[model samples]
Target: MKSLNSDAFRMSIAWSRIFPHGRKEKGVSQAGVQFYHDLIDELLRNGIIPFVTVFHWDTPQALEDEYGGFLSERIVKDFREYAEFVFEEYGGKVKNWVTLNEPWVFAHAGYDVGKKAPGRCSSYVDKECPDGRSGYEAYLVSHNLLNAHAEAYEALKKCEKCIGSKVGIAHSPAWFEPHDFKDAADGASVDRALDFMMGWHLETTMKGDYPAIMKEIVGPRLPQFTQKQKEKLKNSADFVGINYYSSVFSNHVEKPDPSKPMFKQDSLITWEGKNVDDISIGSQPVTAALPVYARGFRKLLKHIKDKYNNPEIMIMENGYGEHFGNKDSVAVGTADHNRKYYLQRHLLAMHEAICIDKVNVTGYFVWSLLDNFEWQNGYKHRFGLYYIDFNDNLKRHEKESGKYYKEFLSQGVRPSAIKRDEL
Candidate 1:
């Protein structure tokens, strides 16, 4: 990363890695603790800021077996203990802390939709899932996750070594546009979609509760925060961390089937890559699930700025993913002009958000630095500036996108000097 003139690296610490079980009382791994110590020291030595995530959806199996993990309130106490342990251990070295990474994804995917680890969903939604309530479990898990974050934040405040540290949750919310701009309902769906997607967790940290729309729609399914929990949750984040990938067109669902209740249907909207006119959102990349729409990126920033009083923000993760089969050679992987274009356009959008809109964005980090084992996709999808040869002892090869980023950073161009159309 230093070679690419990158100054910061965002990484997550697995809860299982630190505590083999769930709690520190069970057993703490000295090797695991030392591993992070060495890694943090090396990053510091290279003058790179380390933004460490406390938890990244990896709940220790012991906790799951004991109390169903985040589905139960018991996990909150354990999470707080784990967070406190880390805060005391490396709090002095790591100033930027992410309490949780994409809690929305974790709860929705793992508990509601059953796409990721510890997959649990209603049998009707996914027969493969062992057992879970489609709409109910996600809300319960997210409720606990919010409380866990509040507890972690409180723990951080008490840690003397972490006095100067900044902590927040990394929220991955896709930008949404109305499928039919002419339809008022479609436009209303966009706001409802954002409320369900981003505001569920975000508004909790800001206002100490979920969006009022969610409370009314989800009703009994959505968990309510206690008066004490509300106080702890309000203003928990020092900064907002956003992991944006793509934007989608949101069409209003006139009436969802009451029989099949799920989190997605709860919002009464359907997300699409094409508008009502069948026009694509923007340019859809071959490997990307959603189309590239940089305009949505700027709009999303402005939305957050206007709604949240322009709090400090960080682009935690943004990049292009490509599907490369075994037959694809290194030459094809190295020539990633599409990825470069994606980066260029998004960066320009972010620049517009900062300069013209005056959004208080502090830093930006790409999705990845090297080809990694993406969860669920495994190694099939690569989203990295540097290509990895899994066949040849994991050899590293820099792609065109890497060169573009390196040059982009080396220039150190001021925002005022950038021409709007040049990018």
Candidate 2:
């Protein structure tokens, strides 16, 4: 494998690395800033573009303790100040900016039915509030997230002559399918499925607010947005970065109970010869690792194009890997053949969006360059093309999949880069 390159390769700046405690008074670490300055140069020197995301959910522990982080509106200004600082100092070196990476996942995973960071909302009713996370607070958090993003977008737009590009957010969309194809109840479940996963984010970023169905169904439980805020929320993103993983099935069920919290998920699966419920309430099992629905990738792209007026879109996070022993390849490493084909197929879909659908698809970045500390899963599920040997030795061996990616780039078909192999 040879020559691998791209106009842009994104890298993250861990929040804790700088603030350590997530506080403004702690002072922005020059070391963190310098690391990226050096990284941006390294990419440039190799003829690769540098795309940077200021916040990727590594909230300073300091912020979390003060008032539950994003749970409170206090994070808006704090986040803005941090973003402003980065734009002012590094705008000269970097062009592309992502304000928040998957605010939905951050909110859902971090709160509500807590699995990620800073943990739960605790109270049941507030979980239904706009600021609530989990499935309920999707509105409050998303509303604030959008305003924060817009404020940052506005700030970045003002300095466009300096930054020289647009600012956006990356959202992971979980595709949904009806549980019972012939049952009307199952079809209704798919709507609820969309509401919980994909619809929640799309409404805010694209339509400029949460879905109307939230109010129609949840009634007063939905968060309130002012007229001015509504305007600001609309058209906030200069581009949309979508992370497509897998699809699920949605089945309608009784309204989510405030007391007996259950995590019901619409799954494209079954048990004992019965199709799994299209929608579940609170605590539901993730039957399969990730629903193997590749076609949903194309439908979502088309949906984005038609629904969002073809806003500049990029597949920011889309890569697959295996965890259990070795699947097809066992060259003493990870990187399953399914992952290689998954990436290649998605990239082709992206090309279709560009060639036929006439979507303003910008660029695509695989989920990770290597298998690293995957939050809760903790390196259990490897999603990297390059298998990371985090065993006693942190050796990174380019797997067959990595070799395939390198070949794709070597064909002179991708953005230019000095291949690590060639180097």
Using lDDT as the measure, which candidate wins?
A: 1
TM-score of predicted structure 2 = 0.83
Per-residue lDDT for 54-161 in model 2, tens only?
Answer: 788877778878876766788788777777777877788777778888887876666555666655554453453333334455445666677778777777777745
Deviation from native of the Cα of residue 147 in model 2, angstroms:
2.5
Every model's Cα RMSD, please? 2.0, 6.5
| Count of clashing residue pairs in every prediction | 0, 24
Where's the lowest-lDDT run of ten residues in candidate 1?
Answer: 414-423
lDDT of 1 by residue, 211-306 (tens): 999999999989888999999999999999999988899999998987888998999998887898999887876656457877888899999999
